[model samples]
Target: MRIVQEFTKGFWKELPPFKLVLGLCPTLGVTTTCYAGIGMGLATTFVLVCSNILVSSLRSVIPSKVRIAAYVVIIASFVVMVEMATQAWVFPLYKGLGVFIP
Candidate 1:
């Protein structure tokens, strides 16, 4: 089925550091240690899911001409919140990621 193919493809066909090939900069930069990598990954996943939901919910209302800007604003807001949370609770991670999160 199409759903199975979609799930399986992520393992090899479209997996990062291989076929997918996008966003390599961040992956390489933050993956110096397992803890740093996992921390950054979870934070990123949270922001991505939140931003996706916000974007989808507002898709109908956002103007076509400024959709890109609107999406950026939505994602940026979540990023700021995540950065603040990390700084407050996980100072080491926030410091490790440094300029990457900003």
Candidate 2:
């Protein structure tokens, strides 16, 4: 019952982090310019959606004891990919982001 409840809760509830002040960087640095905000939002959305898909698909394969570590690694890899891509092509946004990407 609890497992079913947990699985169904996401359909109705928002992610916990969004309700928190976890995106101080985007709210501050990226807000300076519309383009910067768009770039940051796109990068964040891509990483988040991709990572969620990957993690949900691999949840059964990942070990219970180290699932959090596995998730972090997965998210980190996506973040690195986004960062590298941003730096390579969107140099302006990359420079604007500064310390926020990592």
Candidate 3:
């Protein structure tokens, strides 16, 4: 129950893009099509998850001064890999999402 509650909390309370408006540009742009919206949301979620795991693992190694740069590099690399993979294998989805790939 607690686990479900914790997960459910995000449904209305802690939506990263909607509540905080963190990724409004992509949210707004991608939402024009339902497929694009889902694609963008999943992509963002993947990046967030990967970055969170990397940062948590490297928290001790990353200095407070340079953590931001390290995080950006990690996130950018994941985004590039996702973009390339999608372009190569899911060409139709990639074409549909064109400029928004990255």
Candidate 2 lDDT over 1-102, as tens digits, reads 998888667644566765455554564566678888888888888988999999999999999999999999999999999999999999998998878788
User: Model 3: which ten-residue window has the lowest total lDDT?
Assistant: 19-28
List candidate 1 segments past 4 Å from native: 1-19
Which model scores highest in lDDT? Answer: 1
Evaluated against the true structure, the overall lDDT of model 2 is: 0.85
Model 1, 1-102: lDDT tens digits are: 998888889777777677435655565679888888888888888888999999999999999999999999999999999999999999998998888899
Candidate lDDT scores, in order, read 0.87, 0.85, 0.80
| TM-score of each model, in listed order | 0.77, 0.75, 0.71
Greater TM-score among 1 and 3 belongs to 1
Model 3 CA RMSD to the hidden true structure, in angstroms: 8.1
Kindly report which residue stretches of model 3 are placed more than 4 angstroms away from their true locations once superposed.
1-19
Model 2 bad stretches (over 4 Å): 1-28
Model 1 alpha-carbon miss at residue 92, Å: 1.1
